[model samples]
Target: MNQVIRNTALSAAISLSLLGTARADDAKDIDTVVVTANRSAVPADEVLASVTVIERSDIEASQAPDLLSLLARQAGMDLVRTGGPGQTNTLFLRGGIASHTLVLIDGIRVNSANQGNFDFAHLPLSQIERIEIVRGPRAALWGSDAIGGVIHIFTRDPSAGYIEARAGSYGLGGLNAGFGTAHVAIGAGFETQRGFSATNPAAGPGSYDPDNDGYTNRNLSLRVHGDVGTQHVALTGLITDADVEFDIGETAAINRELGIVLWGEINDRWSHSITLGHNSEDLNTPDFDSHFGSERSTLDWVNTFTLNADNTLNLGANWAHETGFSESSTEVSFDEGRRNLAVFASWRGHFGTQTFELSARRDDNSQFDGATTGNAAWGLDVNDSLRVRASWGQGFRAPNFNELYYPGFFGFFAGNPDLRPERSISQEIGVDWLATLSQRVSVSLYRTRVRDLIAFTSPTFGAENVNRAAIDGAELDYHFEHGAFRLDGNATWQDARNALTDLPLLRRPDRKLSLSGSYRFSNDAALGLDASAYSSRPDIGGDLPGYARFDLRGSLPLTAGWTLEARIENVFDREYQLLEGYNTPGRSGVVNLRWNGK
Candidate 1:
């Protein structure tokens, strides 16, 4: 076991740029373009990575209240939260820690540099156009924070005007509208929910409390684009303000994001895209009298050169600046800042039935020395219906602000100035089988090793990089669409162990399975059901029992250009806990009315 762990660690740092054999292809063949898979648009069928695309139609059909609820059903994905809706949430993908995943909104990074994670609870689905998730390491192309995967969100570009309103149990309600022309569009929405007690643990004299934890939010989004001469220019904006009541405190928060993109063809073989973006988040908790804030700005320029019909090359450079501050009390406050610059190059080519991609990157950080990493991936199309892919990649994560500079303001926890960045190597192989015109199946097996994992020591001490983990897992997913019936399902099993103590990782389940199916009627109506089951998972000092939950949804046409939709969550009313002391929602539901003006 010791040797196995050591070998895995070595695999992660291997210098690799093995340009494999195969011809290159674009998204034209599959009609589905995935950018996160390679930092450029590539057909999903030709990419050597595992990917999942959720389009606008899928979101509306799923009736998912938030991003977390929709993503939890995907294979190789898991969520750990402290309470019900509007609470703190963390995502673990492909057995990697929360910080290992990178999130992007319209090609701009959105995770907080100080905290190394994103808040998935508050992102309004009404503003989203699509989501493309590329699973596995791609730091070689994306630069840092890609040990597990990347999720890229595209905001809606609505050209057709529409209005929607929803209301249901727990005081759930919301309204959204979008107006647009051929080259410009604007959207806005507001939502609120009378939540349940975030936590139900027994209380003893200020130790714990149980009360209704409610949440409310308002948001606005806009998109504009037009052609100037031979070039294209676009702008986007998203802003959200929310007030939430947790188990113990009340918080008012606001988030803002803005970006611009420029695209054009310099010549017949060369095309370029430049993006500039900014994101900011501020929050204040009245009960606790605390405040936290973060801001990040980014600039990127990418040039794509079509070497030939069967070959392509991509060159890109990026700059990012981040600043943040946090204060739990007047006596405890800290502010931090950092910046990074990076350049990368990639080549995609193929030989007959096999395809290959080679990528490399160099990143320089203000707080740390420069680092260079690269990877190589290969793919084989055995026939018209089968494809096989395998890849090895390297990734790293810089220490977050709390890990490097926090002064232990709250108490019993301090930062280590000398902490080093965590590093990882990931490997995976998968098979995609198009069994029929209406059905498909995919299976992937992967192993990842993360070193220099930072762990916080107890008893009034500081953090240290004294932990390592070896994560091995398998995922199986299937989808079928025939006539008016659509069914999709996936199952996952993992063995995540601490390399030093040889114990299972905390709060990560060993087995999970989920399935969703829907049927459409002739009257332009539909009905869908979703169910999930999980095995027991380990907690800080104990284990959380396994449980299952079910949900149902339906839609119906009301009148010309009008529709009605409804859903029931937790149909079985199962009582379960994602965290030791938190509470999960019981039976709940919502109904919506919408109108489309074409």
Candidate 2:
């Protein structure tokens, strides 16, 4: 679209605006702060990578059932789940595989080395303060599993006494409470829902189970921090337990994690931050009497030196050790572990009309040889209203324990202990615009090629580096806000195909679009609408048809410091399948009441 026409559309859309209400350009959000961009607070307009932030207010306004559902509607993201909350959920960012995107909680890595993925289904939004998602490869600064993007989750901290209670469709109810002071804070919540059936009636050949696949989840979190003379310290913890029934049987899953940090400005020119964290998960299937568990401990230290007014340098080192074990009634218990150490450096320089960045990292693994990755980027400020950037990066993903060391005695399935890590090269170009004081737009194009992709061998059914792929995509994001209304939307078109077969990668839609709008009746009340469309794509056994879904939400002030909120999801009752044999919810509703004490 022409610049004039696009600007006109942005201006026109605001008059037309849903509870999706904007803060009117002058209120609480005139300046957006993000941390995932450079490990420091940077304005979203100044970031080079595609970024999205979902704040606590956004979550409370939308009333999304879970974290996964909200993320599925975000730009450059695709999600597949077998059932409702507590199901096995997989997320793909910009056509990257499930393992390509790195996930962190309060600066601690959360992906499991056994499954090569994080359990988004079990992550409750009530416990999250804010979420920052950065799109594009970041391996140069973050190391492995960042070939696609990075998602950072910050747990909430309470400033005053607060509480909430709610109930929803299909046996949903929960309670949340928090209390805190200037130097000490704590927040905790608990919620549960009985979900819909998980399986399709007419599944493949003989894989059919007709029953409601209900689920139960419980979660708790705490955050506390204090400061001493010239130093600061903090500790954070989270635990979630779930019981879910799938097509075959019931499984219990538990995740527990803790993070600690101590850091401060050593001197005027130098600052340092140090972090230590531990994460563990335990899963059990009672029917088959199977168990899979993993534990990981990590430490990181970083120092920043100010070279001059326009130049800065950062040096960091990280160490991590992970262990995994699996046991079943029929098979003997097996345990495997690996350790790695990494060092990285990044330089940022600002000159007239231009900003430059360069970063490199090296990791030495106990199970394999050392690997090195690097990235370079340049940003040109065309004027006060526009900025353009280009970047190139290299990344890699280590094989998970299930892929390399899971001992399967059965003739049909086995592991390949010698499998190698998948590696990739990526490039992208983008332009950001601030056409008006309250309107913004961005366009980005990117391509990534991955070699040494791991797959199961045809006959032995063991993991091997037998496949390669190339993915190319373009994205557009727009945000506009005027009096009494707000509009946010994004669209993506991608071609993710097998390098040799040329077939579309499984479950990656070719096109996806989302739009949300909110209209405020007053300062404390609003009505919002959301819409999502996904193009047809390949699945495990066949192709799934394309579909669109709509949701309605509203918020109203009930009393002092209390609000009443409600939402109806799948308003049209569209029938869709994100996975081959999975069923999605149809026309569900939820209501919540909350109190914010300051």
Candidate 3:
């Protein structure tokens, strides 16, 4: 282990040095990035923190259905999507828990206050303009769940008009049509996907068919933008619903979800956004002869102000209410509410030959009885290509409603109302290098000490909820691009140990690596390949071996407005389990025909 750590550190240092020289040669003049990071538009390359961007072109080339699959393909990211379409999804970064990652749409938080996570499967990819990912603790800037990092999604604006329709395997069909002309624009999209169950037939009652489950989903969105004198105005609304049949062993469970979001923005330097949404998850288990349902509603508001060219500030507040019910007629129903308020500030200035940035934020959570948390980060550009950054932040997560009110089977289970919010103090230091005009590299070492880490203890009649543990890790990423060919990869090594028992954290792997490359065959055609490998993880009761998988993508421009795209996933058909009892799909191919109406 020591040798591995040493090797990683040395490699990181060398990569950073090479990247520095490369960035100087590849530097280009670009516009400022308008993001929720600081609630304003700022020069992308000027930001003092580590941020990764995925443009629309990257998404089209990847040919993934949802954000989870696309993000999973990125470096230093771990994603779990249960079964197929319409299932729940979660992401883990830099050894942080799944719930520690915060997700934002336009500038509003999409994470469920009650469930403590976002359902990535429900987010449509067709409407996204771009995705920006910031790694490491960002609680000081975003607050609360930003212990791991932040993922902000920007939807396409109505600057141009477009319409497209596509159909594929497994009852899959889609239609996306929208129009926009500078001041006025509107559009809508719909999609339907079929699901399948995968269970071994030889396993008797515990076994089921892997190709019988099905799912259907639909979505509608409208957006408008206009300029009013010196101020800009924007409005967006979305509604989505899904019905799915998920197979569990010999039984089939039906699930449905409905969600809505409305957001507005005004002016370039000042804006406010709000979101009101609801979701319900219903499940049926034939073996237990029981039916379960959980429902939740959320309201969020965020405001931003650019104090000046060197200063920016942001304020956010949100409230949520949730309830659960069971068909067994037990008093398992409860009403829960959560409120959060936060303030943050960031500044950039130059000191001699070096550019510097300072940022800080404070957050208060009502669920924890007004507990206050804060974080701060600073960065220094040693030169045009050499930059160093350090950050320290505190993050917290309130116990879920199920952990506090759910009753166990046979009336033997009970909820814990005395549980405290899990908290963590994280610190990281990293360097960035622009190795060449078409190459970049970065490395970071981080440590997070968490207190009251929430986890389920002994599960005899019911599981016991408790807090305990710490996680530390390092990450490295490198990218090289030259005209029609590009090479990129990232590796992450981590150690998560239980503070109390001195045992390794369950389900957390020690090593993860991913690499991808793409080549353009002609002005109208391109081919891409991706590969990922994960080390074995110790299971408390099961044996899970290491696994690796590969994927291939190809695209050909057929006409001025139409294109042909194909993707082959699970190229090697390596069967692996990211989570117990959940198996991923095998080799599959998808061909899509896309048209962009100018």
lDDT of each: 0.81, 0.80, 0.62
As a TM-score, model 1 comes out at 0.93
RMSD per prediction, one decimal? 7.3, 7.2, 8.6
What lDDT tens digits, residue by residue, belong to model 2 across residues 287-334?
A: 878999999999988777767667778788999999999998777567
Regions of candidate 2 where Cα sits further than 4 Å from its true position = 1-31, 329-331
Which tens-of-lDDT digit does each residue in 316-336 have in candidate 1? 899999888878765556788
lDDT of 3 by residue, 25-95 (tens): 22332112424444433445555556777876678877876678889866567776556666655677766
On a 0 to 100 scale, what is the lDDT of residue 326 in model 3? 50
Looking at model 1, the pairs that clash are 22-350, 22-351, 22-354, 23-350, 23-351
RMSD of candidate 3 to the true fold? Answer: 8.6
Task: Tell me each candidate's TM-score.
Answer: 0.93, 0.93, 0.82
| lDDT, residue 587, candidate 2 | 89
